[model samples]
Target: MKFAPSWDPTTAIAQQRRDAMLVRLRELRALEQRAVDRSAEARPVFDKRGQLLPRERVGLLLDPGEPFLPLCTLAGYQQDTREAASSIPGGGMVAGIGFVRGTRCMVVASDSGIDAGAIQPMGLEKILRLQEIALENRLPFVHLVESAGANLMRYRVEGFVQGGALFRNLARLSAAGIPVITVQHGSGTAGGAYMPGLSDIVIMVRGRSRAFLAGPPLLKAATGEVATEEELGGAEMHTAVSGLGEYLAEDDRHALGIAREVVASLGWQQERAKLESDPDKDVLLTLMPANLREPVDLREVMVRLVDGGELLEFKPAYGAATVCAQGRIAGHAVGFIGNNGPIDVAGANKATHFIQWMCQLGHAIVYLQNTTGYIVGRDSEQAGMIKHGSKMIQAVTNATVPQLTIQCGASFGAGNYGMCGRAYAPRFLFSWPSARTAVMGGEQAARTMQIVNEAALARKGQRPDPVQAKLQFDQIVEVFESQADAFHTSGLLLDDGVIDPRQTRAVLAFCLDTIAEAQTRQLRPLQFGVARM
Candidate 1:
């Protein structure tokens, strides 16, 4: 495809904005990292208890020197603004997909280091999505589970209802022949008992792992029974008597080692060819924009990603903002949908057709999101924006082939959903540090609100107060801008992770390879999940 450069990256305005974007990116990263470090506040307690930090457990569980994609690192962000300075993130859990002994698996751990690994509503959302990914991708499920069950004080009935899905998914994984391996680090009780109960292989840390339907106090309250921790459901009792745990280790390190060994023993078939590195590194470096707010020719971005930077543009003249192309990343054939601006009538229709065609061809589609939202105003509605956008949304919702999304820039309003944001369940959705997402841009949203307020006052036959309106608008604008930032949205686990732009190609290649392997592998399904023995 012939390429004419759009925005010049070397321009004074672009360079200045690029530097500012980098600064914001760094700020966001630091903020998220600060939350992670907050878990260290309990590090001394963990050490005293002879346990590793949650992330340290994850590190030891995964194979060394391999990539681990951390999903939903931020959960419960800003939910407690009263403690904004020390608000806990990560939903009291740490989870991601990583390789364990050559097997790509979903590894999740209760971050009991912080707040006893209590279940937060947002953490529940994260785990539910994690389960969907594992099931869809055929990844083996590995959980380092030891949760505080639920916090009744901050609990919602909705969270309680939804939390059942995590348990249901464990059974589903086992029945689907996707092995469920878990290490009960500590306090797997009450609602948490089912974690080990459903796993194909269970590893327990002796003297620490406590898997019980009820603790002693609860048992006494319910049945007037008195029991010690060991009598109730300790690791030794479960492994030796209850037949719940398959392996028992002396300590946290030992348990993780055993879990790794279990993964190594599973002879999962791998048919994926290694992704060959592209020679277009220099081209990708030169073409991709550093400043996300600056309009970018997505063609340049696409060219830098595809194999040898070659692609066949699909209907280039129609829906210019919604770019559709067929190309290969690391020799894997895929379609790409990206945006340079907003999705309009033409853009939505283009996406629908492109998605369907790719589905027919059994090709994966990678979405590079960069749009304010669907077009609005009189002309857009006249052009059937809603109908076409609905059709596009439907196609994205049901496309049979695996979908991946990258939030490279603006992902706002329905545009986020249409572009396969986290809510759309892309096989793997990641974001660049440059990405920003919201219902709408700050100024646009503020103006819309301001207009609505003026109209309301007019309907009441009251004179509109311009000064009061401006104040309200400005406050809303500030709030929107603060939360709409890429880092901010990402800190709430809006995407998988805020990734480096330079690593885009490699990340996409790895994900593509992972999905391809999953598609090729066969499973041995059973009517029921594997029973503990």
Candidate 2:
């Protein structure tokens, strides 16, 4: 029998704080959901135009009741700065991994209801990452594309340049034997025309879909040429005359039906054996203290995750703070690196060794993150913390195996770097609802700045102003705390998404299966992508 983690529920102040954290997490999620609803609900104009909302189109494209693991819903969040009231409607796209006619594929839709589905700077980043995921996983890419092209008035030169890669990736997917299917539900002029242009199969909705290199107004302005919407790039012209669209649908629903049929015709079959569930998985909720101020044992969390709660710890005593262990999640072999406390020189070295070992074994690696950071002090500095920490980071960065990170709490400082934080580009990254990430703790950051201020005052031959210093410190703390929370990081698209603690095991297993399937599947690589001719 696998040993179960000793259950200990927080009480008094700890319980009070944890409860507050839960409330805040819910509030942030509610705010994000409001943005989603706003995209679908506030868009009455779609109904007037006799069209479905972006989300509705996504729903119709997927198999009913199938799981949809939505990615990067909160991308480019506060980065926009103008509309901080609600999130930016999923960075202008509705995308996820789901089933269509029993074939697993990546489904994407432009949230045209918002800003006419103009791909924002962050929207561009989100699509780039999504395309990369689809390519990496060897999954068919399906897009419900209806973009108004890039926002010309708000355009950035860098974004314009980077946007070209989107079309290139579409072609790459087809060349890699991963089919690219697109449903053109509306305008796709200028740069957006390539979304359907580069796809292996294209379905155009009659009377709605349009794909022109330049719209009529732009053509008239740039040249003496004159053309109507229909004459330029209408569905009928593309389907019957231009050979741009392989199939033409009467409406949005019909377009989605044809897309599903395209998936069915692919002849792909995926057999998944359901991992045995933990009868007492209710523990996923109660394992970590709601407040990151309290201590957590990653081992305790790990035991509950792996099969039979059995794990083989690697080098337990040398660097006790940083933990390396081996276990099986859903019967898939996994190597885990977790934190019980700060990582020191010894811990970094241990992690470096463990990471290299996992790479040699060709196994998947999981990071259970929770640390204030790598240890700092004069004594630690001389001990080569930087060198060893660099080695650890280097190992994580170059590991040949698939790596996934779960932010449980306090993903702060170089600890975040050493633990394969978002910047490290793990195949999949997620955070628990209460997880907090920053360069350091809010108090720590404030104190460091306060000391600097005091030193400056001392040099000016004045006594340290305690009151003035306290006010400044408090302001700094507030800024750090607000931005470090999981909601904020997720809003910034640091991780894939903020998931409920209860879903960690299932999420981990699903991703493992995805990586495994990709590894085993065969692809026919071609020198060039399939041309529309």
Top model number, lDDT:
2
Tens-digit lDDT track of model 1 for 196-283: 9888999999999998999998999999999998989999999999999999999999999999889989987354466566665434
RMSD values for the candidates in order, in angstroms, are: 2.7, 2.3
Per-model CA lDDT versus the true structure: 0.83, 0.86
Stretches of candidate 1 above 4 Å error?
2-11, 82-84, 269-293
Worst 10 residues of 1 by lDDT: 282-291
lDDT of 1: 0.83
Model 2 misplacement above 4 A: 1-4, 10-18
Error of 1 at 71 (Å): 1.1
lDDT of 2 by residue, 1-533 (tens): 23346755554653564566567568757766866776776467888878999989999998897677888877777777735674463788888888899878889999987888889888888888889999999999999998888998897899899889898899889888899999999999988998888998999999999999999999999997999999999999999999999999999999999999999998875787787877656556665666687777788778778888888889988898998899999889999999989999999999999999999998899999999888989989999888888999999889999999999988988899889998988989999887899998889889999888778888999777678888889999999998997767877778888887767888898888788878887877776777896
TM-score for predicted model 1 compared with the true structure: 0.91
